[model samples]
Target chain A: MACETDKALLQENIEEYIKDDNKVVTCKWLSLMHSIDINVAKRALHIFVHHQRNKGGNDDINVTFFVAGLGKSKDGDLMHKCAVVPETELEVVKRSLATVTSCHIFSVQKAKLKDYTPLYMTDYEVIKDNIDKCNRFSSIKCPWVSLKSGLSASKSAQQDVVKVVLSENKGHAFSNKTETGNDSPGSKTRALAKKVEPKGSITSMFASASKKDGGGNESSKPVQKTDAASKIKATKKKGGVTAFFEKKGDSPLKQKDVLLGKDSKKMDASSERFESNVTNEKKQDPKRKKKQAADADEEAPDKKRRRRIKTDLFDSSDDEDVEAGEPEEPEEEIEEMEQFEVLDKGIEEEHKMTEEEQKEEVDDSSLTKSAVVGKKRKRTKKVVSKHYEDEEGFMVTKKETVWESETDEEDEASVNKQEKKSHQSNTSEDMGKLATKNTKAKADPKGKAAAKKNSSPQKSKQTSLMSFFKKK
Target chain B: MFEARLVQGSLWKKLLDSIKDLLNEAIFDCSSTGITLQAMDSSHVSLVSISMNSDGFDTYRCDRNLSMGIHLPSLSKIMKCAGNDDIITMKATDDADTVSLVFESPNNEKVSDYEMKLIDLDTEHLGIPETEYSCVVKMPSAEFQRICRDLSQLGDSVVIACTKEGVKFSASGELGTGNIKLCQSASTDKEEESVVVDMNEAVCLTFALRYLNFFAKATPLSTQVQLSMSKDVPLVVEYKISELGFLRFYLAPKIEDNDGDN
Candidate 1:
């Protein structure tokens, strides 16, 4: 492959090329034209330049050398510099640089070259023509340049395909796990086991053994285990089971509704119509029912006592009328009977009072009834008068007249029998009164009282101070 | 082996002081032409680029292309030990883990050498293209630094508006609003002190005063600071390091969510 004649011919061609004093010739351009190595071209150029200098042609020929070395930067840091300088200034340029790494004849020209741009352009044209084979004869080697070839490109494509397939499989498995885990813990564990069976055969072997022991028992045991595990996990959380119960306890109205259903049925048969009316109202406005149910639950005991006293007042008034008609008593006794009727009207008027005021009136009426029953001979008439402004801004006066009967020993037992009969009749009248009065008072001060009650309890139900700190 | 000697040693100290607060560690790429460093701040809101040509050095030599990762604060500390007139020399091997710095007193009575460990840093070189800005303003660096420092007292951000008449910097905050304007001066004998505005169009942009204040630390490096601005592009603040090279800062403008207030 080494030919001496071919080298001589390349030398002859270079000699002919340099014969023109106006043209500049570079090693890269010489190497490309002759199809030779760059280092050989550089040596050829050096030998030709020396031959010209030896022939006393130095004054006509000009040579440029490529120098690369380190030089001091402005900020005291060392920097590398590479330059092409003419032969006349080579020594001066070399001294300016701290060190010279490489220095050789880059190009030879007859005319003194002021700009190196034409030389670079000439070399760039040759390099551009043979770009694919340009680095074949060069000494420097870069690994990445070779790695960007056809074989590595195919290899990288295969790796990308493998990565995409792996990512898709991972995504599919992730989506499957989330979908199966949404419904229940027992099903979630089973789904996980099913997914892991392909990856780990040991788990599947255990599952098969458990299935063979008892087919149905296998499912039941895991369900119970998961239930216990979830319970334990819930307790391990910050709020624990108490938080779970507190959430349910927040709505006490639901619990009262359940209790009220049973209590109203067992306690009083007279209030059955009243309870039905309340249920109808609850169905009409569900939002207001919570407040009303809370009010009814709190006032349930007081309301029962007030109902019983109203019945007693009606019964005593009926007995007084019977005695007044049969005995033809004096004017005072007739006046006492009239007062008994007025007291019954007063008991009816008590319904319009606020809950606290109604509670006080119920206590007073019960006390008077019991005291009058104990002292039958001392017939006294007590008149109770109350004045208050109604919702319509009108001052209404309520007069309660309490009359005691002068009863003989024999008449007392018969009076009790007639009183029991009147008790039955008064309950029917009481039901009619509650149906009319409660329906009308739905938008009155009763609603305001329910709102005030609702707000007070909500203010008291603040989060516990301990909840602010995390449990260890 | 590589070595570089500089007579003005205090220039290195000032360069370190200007960039130490912005960059904790940076990679210096040394090539045949010069040494250049480009790095973004930790928040990625601003970038600093430094370039110094080898022609500017008194004596420089490098055998191969090398990249050295250096901690700026430690380098600053080493620089502080040298006198302002001391001659500084930097030396390193081709494949070395540490760089050596030698400080020689001008009178040759004292000399001290320090070795600093080099770190391996993963760096991505961002390509900043050459753009034609709408406005370019040249003014005394001290005046620019003073304006930045004063505006920072009023607001977190300063709005820079450049018009045909003058360049204005305004800042509004809880305390109050402050405005400073610099009109282009006529030709003067003292060129460095004169303000010059070369504008093709008007541009108004907002920038964080905190970062502008940090960039102002380079005021001692040069007499004049050059500012280039365009709509939606980062503002470029450049300070020429004498006849050596330039240190430039690229600051991303603040995006206004409510454009009604300008």
Candidate 2:
């Protein structure tokens, strides 16, 4: 694709080119016209003319493609997931897809270097979507010489600097040959797997796995496990299970409503009346169970007390100690609780959640649904955020996703949740075990006061809990 | 690679700071060989964690695993001895009480190593945790610092009164009271700091001359400071360091009438 028209003539169609409103491409098209990867133009034409069934537009495919993709993409935002700053070492090519789209060139200095304009946002999706069409590039006015003059890359990576003729994915620095070679029709649609990635790496295998097994499929669990195992093996040489996450976010939102959190457009705020209703559920349920509990209270109230305290990680440790299951059993549990507090302090300081806070989630399904009501608009936060990840850690500000991700912070949260929950139910399941211990202290009415004296130091327990939850 | 759980005393920093009984040092317990000490400075409120774990080292050798107990004075001295470009090397042998710190500069020109022995200091510190407050406002730290800096120009004593609306930092001299409202804030061409505030909670507390004078230290660390208050609760100064941690200061709010309205 080369400039056949004057710069003045093409300036007339700048508004039309900018109409697509893709934040990344709109910014990069200007750079491509003057200094695009010669292969980028050639490949884009190959895809648009051949794969997209616009084959006859070889005349216009060269012109309008860059304008539609890069021109419009930059106009919105130069959202780049992450940039490969000059000093990235040990970053794996097999697992990582290193894409440098027309968008990531935030500010391309012209021949003068002083005057510049913003370029395309080079995230995987934005580039993948618009670059498939080439007729769009025909509209742009290339101030630089034609494609024949631009194919200057000695190696593919140099395409970042040189303006290449054919806009192919070749020399694109990202994508293995086979992956990039799929500009074919059936293959083009088949390869949309890189759009939404799980496991956080920009790898082809992981990306394809996410595409095949995403959207709350129970099958995703195994895929996730396999991906996680592979990732752990890849990341930690000679690795065992380095990380495990038990994701139990607020019990408030129902499973269906939880899915709505990802579907930003589907959120309905009018249903928030359910939040106040759930908060009242506990009080209401007690009333419903009042008569049954009142009769049971006459005889130890054992079942009610056990049922009520079963879910609490803290209370279970106390119960285990009195049972004499082991002499020094509670010490380990106490230590785990203590470590939890330090973790909480760190998360609280960062405005995130410790696993402890997540573990105590009591049917938060209603609370989340209420939180996501009319307040929920059709926002593409994840998409925009993906663009900027190249600068910051690709942080998605979808509050719900972030809140959910918080539970799996280091997989420690999930481990503690299981350790605490199962320990609580251990004593209640077998009273025969507690009854076997015969070392009963001499019975005295003063036992209550003595217990209080011994437990005075344990008051730090509350503070520990606060530190764990980062109680404000 | 190694996560050592230290089951020690729980002393809440926020609670302890209320009565001026906060610990002088941060005692981080870590087992030797497979561990990480990733700390971001409290001054830069946005978090930057510095993590160097067992895997991070190419050749990590530890004969025995021991719990780490670092004191404040030792840390300060080490920071003073180390230069910016110095490669810091810490080595402690098995059963060794002291860890050696060596600084190797460029080209075998100079290398310095020093060992500081571990001292037994009581970890438990008594702190008064109770305090009541009047008001609290979470404002951007940049704006708060600007107000403090701008008002400090008028006089040394800045009477910071708060309302449900916003915080007012006013100082008077022979001229008049210099007031600044950080609530409804804007930026000019020269300045580019704008924050959308959800500041429904507000507090009006008057700080003493020297207190606001010294508070000049906190603003640079964080972008936002949540100023918490109660009539009796010491005013809480909170700032978030990006993603790392929060550094907070709790000051006893001075009621002017208590000192005969001086």
Candidate number of the best TM-score: 1
lDDT of 2 by residue, A1-472 (tens): 3443533333333323433332223323442443444344344333323432343432221122221121112223222333322111213321232343432212211112211123222322333333222223333333442222111211121222222222223323233444454344433332333332322222332234333322111122223333221221122221112111111211112333344554322222211111223222222223213433443333331212211222344544443344332223343344333322222211121122222433432112222333444333111111111111212334222111111111122212221211211222333423332222111321112243445423322111101111211212
Candidate 1's DockQ is 0.01
TM-score of 2: 0.25
The worst-scoring run of ten residues by lDDT in candidate 1 chain A lies at: A415-424
Question: Cα deviation in Å at residue A361, candidate 2?
Answer: 81
Best by DockQ: 2
lDDT of 1 by residue, A1-472 (tens): 3577776776677667778435678987787777777789899898888777787734487799988787654444454666789988899889988989888889987767879888867766665555445545555444544423432332243343445456446645664666543434444444454544442332233334332322111121122222221222222222334334323332342333243454222222222222323232222224223433545544432323333443444454343443432332443333333222223222221233344433333333333433543433433343433333444545555453433233422232222211111122234545455334322332233344344423321122212212221222
lDDT of 2 by residue, B69-167 (tens): 455455556645655555555566555566666666645488887777764533321243554445656666667767777766555455566775556
What are the per-residue Cα lDDT tens digits for candidate 1 across B85-126?
999988889999999999999998999999999999987777
DockQ-based CAPRI category assigned to the predicted complex of candidate 2: incorrect
Q: Pick the candidate with the highest lDDT.
A: 1
Instruction: Name the docking class for model 1.
Output: incorrect
In angstroms, give how far residue B47 of model 2 lies from its true place: 20
The global Cα lDDT (0 to 1) of model 1 is 0.62
The models' CA-based lDDT, in order, is 0.62, 0.35
